[model samples]
Target: MTTLASVVSCLSDYDPNALPVAQAQAIMRDFVQPVSGVARVPVRSALDRVLAEDVLSSIDVPSHDNSAMDGFAFASAELASAAGEVSLRVIGTAYAGVAFDGAPTAGEAVRVMTGAVMPAGCDTVIPQEFTQGDANTVRFARDAVRAGDNRRLRGEDLARGSAALSAGRTLRPADIGLLASLGIAEVSVRRKLRVAFFSTGDELRSIGEPLDAGCVYDSNRYTLHAMLSRLGVELLDMGVVRDDPAALETAFRTAAENADAIITSGGVSVGEADFTKQMMAKLGDVTFWKIAMRPGRPMAFGRITSDGPNSQGAFLFGLPGNPVAVMVTFYHFVRGALLRMMGATDAGAPLVPAVSATPIRKRPGRTEYQRAIAALNDRGQLEVRLTGQQGSGVLRSMSEANCFVVLAHEQGHVNAGDTVQVLLFDGLV
Candidate 1:
C-alpha cells in the first residue's frame, strides 16, 4: 500500500527529470514487496527457490561421536606417564559402518577407519600414517596427538532443534546437499514469479517477418527472454506491439491481468512514436519518467491495474528501445526489483575492483555502464578495457564483452591505470 508520491516526497534531492542511480534504486527498494505464494517441492527440485520458512534440524548430524580418519583410537590419559614412545596392544579393527563391540582397556588401542564410531572409552586417535603399527600392536611418539585429536563429536555439524536454513534464503546446490544430509525430503519455497514482457515500436519486426525500408528485427525481446530465463521466472513473451495507442493499451492491459510484472522495451523515450508513455500514464501511477543515466535516460515505472475485478496490478518497467540500453537498464533496475518481489534474501552480486587499461572520457552528472572485457594482466591484477563502441544501439559490444565498467555519478574521467569498479556477467546476468 506504499504510494510512489509518499516515497518520493521523503527524499531531499528527488528529481524525476534527472534521477540518480542510487536514489532510483532506493525508491525501487521501498516500493516493491515480496510475493506471498508458497509451495512444497522436493529438495532436489528446490534449487534456486527462496525458502518460505525456517528449517530446523530434527536430529543430531552425526548421531554419535565418530572417527574423522583412519587411525588408532585409545584413552589419552596413559600418554601423560610415557617416557619417549608409547605403544599399546591392538585390540580390534572398526570399519566405517561398524563399531568396536567393547571399549579398549588401559594400554590398549583399536584400529578405526574413517567415520567409524569411537569406542566407548576412547578419547583420542593417532592417524595410521603417524604410527608404526603391526597387526598386534601400535607404536607412536607420546606427543604425536592431543586429547581430542581426530575425534568428531555428535551434532558437530547440525544440532537438533537448531535452524538448518532460514526463510528467504535462495537454495544453492550446497544447500540441496545439506538438506539431503539432514534427510529432508521436501521444502517449502516461494512460487516462481510470473513476468510478461514485450517490445514496442512499429518499426520493429519479429524474426520471420519481412523487413521494410526502416524496420529492423526486434532483438530486445530475445535478449529479455535469455535474461529472464536465467532468473528462473515464468516468462510470458507477448511478442512485439506497435507504436499505436490502441495496441499499446491492449498490451499493457493484457500484461497487467496475467502477470506480476510487465517489461516493455520501447516507447519510453520522448520520441514521436512514444505511445507507450501515454498508455502508462492512463493505466496507472507512473513513478518516474526520467533517469540521469547514459543510453537509458527516459524510462517508466508504474503499478498498472488491470480491468479485471480481482487484479492487484502488475509492476511496470518500460525500458528503452535500444538493445544495449535495455540490457543496462534491466540489470541496474529491473533485476533487483524482480528479486525483491520474488522474496529472495540475496542482495545480488558485488562490484569487483579492477584497473582501467585505457583512458576514458565521461561526464560528471550521470552514471554510465560501459561494456568491456576484463582479464588478469602479467602482474596478476585484473585490467579492463572497453569494447569498440559504447553506443546504446551497439548490441555487438554487449555480446562481445564479459563485464561492465561502472562509472559513478560524480566520477568525471578515467586516466590510464585508474582503479574502477567492474561487475562481471558470468553468473550475474
Candidate 2:
C-alpha cells in the first residue's frame, strides 16, 4: 500500500494549498487501489463492467469458411485461364446457416447467401451485384474478384483457445455481441464499485423543501448522482449532511464502511466554518488541496476508514460546492481516479483541437476549463466559443455547452482564430 505521506514526500514541489492540477491528479492516481472481487455474470449483464480475466475462445468464430455476402461461390482457378468474361453453371442455392451440398467443380458455382458456409472446394465469391446472370447461370468479368475474395475463412474472427477479449476492458454493447458470437453465455467481471456521495453544507436543501433565507436547493447531489451513474458505479446517495462535526463524522464513517469511494461536495474550502475539515483530519489519511485550476480551486483527496472490527476503507473526493466547479473537478480529476479504483484499463478520451471563434482573457499560472460550444464551420473547421457567462455557479452554461475549452497552465490569452484543445461531452460515447 502506498501511504499518502510516502507519496507526498517524493514530490519536491508538493504543496497542498497550491497544488498543480496535473500533480494533484498524479497523487490520487498513485494512491487508489482497485477493489478486489469478481462476479460471474451473464454476457448481457456484463455490459459496462470490467472484465476480470482474459476471455479465451472455446470454439472458432464462424467455425468454418463462409461467404461474406450474397454471392456466387466458385473456384478461382478457371478465371485466371479465361480470355475475357467468364460464366459458370450454378449447382444449388446456399442460404445463411446452411451449407452447400458438395464442392463445385472447376467451372461450376453455387449461389451463396451472406454467412453461408463456402463449398468444400470454392475459394472465392463473386457478389450478386457484380455477377451479370440469374441464379441458373452466373456470369461476370474475369477480373471482378480474385482468389479468396469475399470468403471469410474459418477462425478468421477468433480461433479456438485464442483471446477474444483482454482483461480490464470495460465491456460495451459491442463487447456483449462479441461474447455472444463466441457462444460465451457468462463472463467473469469486476463487481460494480459502490460510491457513496453527499453534499455537506448548512445552507443547502433538497428539492420540495421550503427555501430558507440563506439556503439554496441542493443541486450538487443530483448532478453527482448523474455523473457517477454514467461511470456505472453503484451509488449511495447519503443526501445532505449537516455542518455539525458529529454528523459529518458519522456520514464519513458509514460511507467508508459501505463503499469503495466517498464523494462529498462543499465544506473543503479554507473559509468554511463547518467541522467537516476537522472530522476529515480525525479520520484516515486525507489531504486538503487548493488546485491551480479555475472554478474548482478548493478540493480534497485521500482515503478514509471506518472504526472497530469491520474497519472498512474507501477513497475520498471532497469537491467544491459550486455547481460548475463540482462537475469540472470531477471530470478533470475524480473521474479518472474512480476508473482506476474499479480496475478499468480505459484511459478516457483525449482533448480535441479546435480554433477559437472569439478572443478570451487568460493568465499563465493556472489551468482553466471554460464551458464552450464547439462546432464545425462552413469550411469544416472546428471552432469553439464560450457559453455566455463563465461563473462557477452558472450550471446553465454547462447545460448549454457541448465541451470544455481547456487552457493549459502556462497558456496566456487566446486570440480569435487561435487553436485550443477541447474535451467533448460525447467523447466516451
Candidate 3:
C-alpha cells in the first residue's frame, strides 16, 4: 500500500494541469454535500447571512403612490396656460405621513412634502425651490414640470410578489433596508455553517503565553477565526490542541458531533509526529490527501462519520501549520467548500488579471502563490509588486500583501511588466 507520505510525494510529480485549480475545486464541492436544512432567523440577525430561499416582497415597496419631493402637487393641465410663470391655489398641505385626501382641480394644487402620498388627481410636482409659495398660494417658474415628476408610484421600487432577493444571496445593508421596506421582519436563511477550528503541534503556544525555546505562538486559529467570521460562520474555537493522539481524538470527536465542518492547522504533513492524518483514518475516511501547490501541499479533506442514533456527518479540512500556507489553503480550499455547503451554486475566489510591477522567478512544477502588494500604476492600471520574501512561514509578508500574484504551473520566470492573474484577498486577510 502507498504510504500517505509517498502519496503526497507522487502528487508533485503529476501534471499540475491534471488537477487544475478549477477541477480541484469542483471535486471537493462535488464530494462534500451540503447539510440539508434551513432555519428562520430574525431580520436583525440576518445581516451577512445567506438566504436559504428566495425572499419575495410581501407588499409594494412604497405601498402606495407617494411624493418624492416636498413641493406642490398639481394637475398637468394647470401649467398649460402659463407662458413664463404660473400661479395656483394651494388647497391643502401634505406631510410625509399625511395625504391631501382630495384631488387637485384644474387650477388648484396641494402643498406636498417628500414621502407623502400623491393626491388622487395630481400628476406632477414642482419643487418648492422652483416655486414661490405663500400661506395658501404657490407660483411656478417658467419651466414646465413633466407629468409624474417627483412622484414615487406604488411598487416602483419593488412589485408585490416579485423576488426581492434570490436564494444564496449574502445579505448586505441595502438588502436589509429593502426587506424592512417590504415589512419582512423575519427571513428564512441557511443556518450558519458551524466550523470548529484549531491548531496542533507541541511547539505551538497561545499568544501572551510564555514562549519556550522551540515553540511559536499560535496564529492560525485566530486568523482562520477572523476569516470565517467575515463569512458569517458560527465558529467553535477549539483553541490549540497538542500533538498527542488522545487529545487529537477528543477534539475530533467534539468537533464532529457539534460542527458542520472542522478545520485544523498543522500535523497533516508527513512528519512522524503528525498524528492528525492517523486520527482521521481511524475516525473518518480521507477523501483526498494532497494537491499540487506550493506552501499548502499537505492540505487534506474528508468527512467524519458517526454511528449514534442522531449521528450527523461533518466535513473536515486540515491545513499546513505555516501561517501563510494556512491562509493560502483556506482561501483556495476551505472558503470554496464552505460556500458550496451553504448552497452557493457558484463560489470561488476571483482571479483578476494584472501587470507585474517587477520580475518574479519560479520553477515549472508546483503552482505558486506569491504575496503581492497591488496598486494602480501611473496609467491607472493595476500593478502588483512582490513582498520581501516568499517563504511559507513569513507571516509578515502575508500581512503586508493585499493579493496573491498567481503563477501557473507551466509558466516559468516572469519578467517585469508581464501580465499575470492576481487573486485579491478582498479585505479578508
Model 2 misplacement above 4 A: none
The lDDT values for all models are: 0.90, 0.91, 0.81
Q: If ranked by lDDT, best first, what sequence of candidates would result?
A: 2, 1, 3
Q: After the best TM-score superposition of candidate 2, give how far the Cα of residue 336 lies from its true spot, in angstroms.
A: 1.1
Model 1 steric clash pairs: none
Task: Output the TM-score of candidate 3.
Answer: 0.83
370: Cα error in model 2, Å: 1.1
Give the TM-score comparing model 2 with the true structure, all chains together: 0.97
lDDT of 2 by residue, 364-395 (tens): 98999999999999989999999989999999
Find the candidate with the highest TM-score and give its number.
Answer: 2
Model 3: residues with Cα > 4 Å off, grouped in runs: 1-18, 77-89, 131-145, 270-274, 306-310, 344-355, 362-367, 376-383, 407-422, 427-429
lDDT of 3 by residue, 202-313 (tens): 8999989999999888989989988898888888999899888999988888888888999999987766475888888788866444566777877677777555444476
Report clash pairs, candidate 2: none
In every candidate, how many clashes are there?
Answer: 0, 0, 0
Q: Lowest-lDDT window of 10 residues in candidate 3?
A: 1-10
Please estimate how well model 2 matches the true structure, expressed as its whole-model Cα lDDT: 0.91
Candidate with the larger TM-score of 1 and 2: 2
Which candidate model has the greater TM-score, 1 or 3? Answer: 1
lDDT for 329 in candidate 3 is 89
lDDT of 2 at 250: 91
